[model samples]
Target: MVLLVPIIGGVVALGLLVWCCVCRRKRSSDDEPTRPPDTSSLDTAAKSLGFLETLLTDDRVLIRRRFDIRDIQFERPLSKGAFGEVWLCTDRQNTMLAVKKLLQHKNDAYKEIKDFIAEIQLTASLDHPHIIRFLGVAWTSMDNLCMALEYLPTGDLLAFLRQNADMLTWVKDKLPMALGVAHALEYLHNRPTPIIHRDVKAKNVLLTEQLQTKLIDFGISRDRTQETMTAGVGTPYWSAPEVLEGNRYTEKSDIYSFGVLLSEIDSAATPYKDVRSPETGEPLRVWQIVSMIVGGSLRPTFSDACPQRIARVAKACLDGDPNVRPSANEVIEMLLGRAVSDQNW
Candidate 1:
């Protein structure tokens, strides 16, 4: 009856082996936070899976495989969004680059690593003084897709506006931001191949040490030259009439967006306000904002300090007819106090 000792011993040994493997896996997961194995990086894993190659054919892999992400010094996360989390990162050369870590889930077969890689590529190609410089990229076998970008420590325009709302102080901060951002838009719009920053919100505009405004977060941005579209999207409040009609977009679309951004920056008011239902408190999306602007329901809500000239500048940008909108250069001239009014003629 008690002769089953050998069988029981084998079962116990098998259980111990399973337990050891589980413990080893747990240890491996923990080790990655400190010094992850090279093979576990998204770059390596993507190569191994071949999913990145297949999926990145569109725009995600346009400029990948350029710069190397040899080493990284991870810092606290600066912001989080639907696309990913942006972290302050220092590259191998000790250059500070903002790293965007995608939360696209582990084992996602879509191969967005190329897009992750492409962001750096697209960024590096632009050399405008007003735009944020594209530094480099970090690709490995890790679950993360780290994009190393020039770090702008002064934070975004939204923060700048929130902290300096009073008119006495607003003028000091507002003028530079408006002028700088106008220059950025002018640069993007005037490019041989134009680009539309589809998500042109206050949060996306970062300020530098010199107080110059730099555009950031092009996740939803469409390089108008690269990807021409009859219909696409952008933030609601800033969306123009042509965009709302689902018509083709061009540099003028960006102008329309700038108009809304100008309104938001000058007035310091949230987009699509006073329209939320009291029951749910949920707000509308970009499409809804576009609808409102299209229906003539949206207005700039100009402040007392917002000069009529600025009003006209904003209106020119927000004009329902994209054909009638002013160029970024024109906006810049107006903002810089060099605008020649039509009345002068």
Candidate 2:
């Protein structure tokens, strides 16, 4: 037994010596200047350990840009609205853009300023063919927020309708424009959290060189899921009766406004512009027309040129009962069905 112990100890020590020599030789081989470490194997091990994902999981691709005010040069003021003034601006790259600048200086301008910023942010996230595209936002040295939006060379729908009244003859121009606006509304209302465009008027609809209609001006828009219904937030002329009455308005209010816009497009004039006052027998003032709308008596008069089907769709939209009013998607179906029926005949 004692002799076997000595032999076993000698074998164990010899095995230890061989292992140490092998490890030393491996270290010396690793230190060779000409031999590069197996980085491909190391990368495979790293991926197996999720090291790459751990480093890149937090590295997100930024989709929005922050522009410096100095990069933009204002050319001229295009138009002024309740929220801000839009200008024709030129960027550092000599790119022409339309910039909306909020000029609220009053003490009570916080909400208005917030809405302006919100519109910029909201518009930035939307990407639809019929919805206006947002470029980026600029913070002026004077601490004012401005939005750079896509420039529509053909002006707004109101101006286009007035200047080109001959184009609204039939299915070629006017119906397509109406359908485009309807599709934009559908896009907004069909979002997971529906967006109600508080202001939907001809003046807020821009036209491109190809006469493509695009919806714009989301200063007073509300998300159905997140926002509380507020009344009296839209333009009085194009606003729905319920909105004028300071009632809790819904997406149906936009349909009512779109009805008015249809009338504007058909007549090539502003709503109530030609309507005579019942009592005075003269052209009614804007306030008087608003009163009539709230009274549920006066509505936009359809011109003789307006097709009966289009008029019917508009009438349905202008229904006093919001519950009976058709949704934007329904409006498109009505218009398209009418078009198909007419063609079939």
Candidate 3:
């Protein structure tokens, strides 16, 4: 009986220590301090590296618009962000495309511009049904970056949920959608030089009319062969624990972010709710997500319209441990909403 009291005290002490560490991490943005991390040197250290071939393939791979881009007009603005806008464009070839027009940064260095070009090149190199296809790219004047891609008319998953879908339809919809997304992510993650879609969230995942999920927006994606990101490189919501902790890059981290994304999908909303966070008394950094779920601070209960089985999968995906979080392939199988062949992931 006396030994129990000391053990209880030790547990309380451990909890306090954890609180202090979390508080310290929040109070000081110390984690983001590393910068200008000699990417050249870092690249040398990578266990495996993606061929810069996509970027190096040169001017021949780039197809300049034959018809005046002005002549082949876009039907509507598909989306807008800090980097210019996206439009639904139709070429004289009658190919429907989603064009991303990037705003030129006058002060941007040559290397920075090349990096953006690299992203476009990477997209163009892949031709997968689950991946958003890169049709072509053009530098309209040096400053602006533009990419022509296969147009997806059905929009993203969040938009579908907002339409007031019923439970049965929601399950039917999410499962296949998740499977497609899993295929895309697994293909990226399993490469010799694995590509971490550093940003994996509802919005970046696009759905086609056929319901196949296509991964878009690799602006912040990283080659996992490298040790770590150069500090400030990910969208806050789907950022992983190690990313927040400023640890080295690992494929497991993407799995962590995927968990958040999966949870958000079931909840029918973006992962981070912009509400005041109880932990730091400020907006939550991404890793606070684990605490939020464990502490019951954030609830991802699916809407009444969502299926019960789908909701369970969402919760499982959000499991705090990245090791336990299922792979994108596993996610695909689950989305089929069939019996999981093995409970051990």
Best by TM-score: 2
Order the candidates by TM-score, highest first — what do you get?
A: 2, 1, 3
Encode model 1's per-residue lDDT on 1-345: one tens digit a residue.
000111222332332233344335533442233332356576865454455534333445434533555577886888887557888877667777787778766543233444454455566667777788776545554355566667898898877777767742335777678778788888777777777776677878888888788887766555775533444345545656665555556888888878878777876766556554234656544444344556554555566677676767777787777777778888888776687764221
**1-345 in candidate 3: lDDT tens per residue?**
000011222222332334446445543342233213334564642311223223334445554421235534678898986655789988887778898776554332333455566677677666678889877765434344577888888888777655644452544666677667778888998777788877777788888877778888887677765443433355544555445444444666676666666655666667556544444457544444433433333434455655666656565565555677677667666666665564753
Q: State candidate 1's TM-score.
A: 0.72
lDDT of 2 by residue, 1-345 (tens): 000011222222332233344435533442244333345575654443343223222322212465778898999999986557999999988898999887766532434454555566678768899999888766633236677889998999999998989756757899989999999999999988788998899988999899889999987787776434556456776777666655566889999989988888888887766666445667655655555566566688787777888988888888888888888988898888743332211
Ranking by lDDT: 2, 1, 3
TM-score of each: 0.72, 0.76, 0.69
lDDT of predicted model 1: 0.63
Error of 1 at 181 (Å): 1.1
223 in model 3: Cα distance from truth in Å?
A: 1.7
lDDT, each prediction: 0.63, 0.72, 0.60
Question: How big is the positional error of residue 302 in model 2, measured in Å on the Cα after superposition?
Answer: 1.3
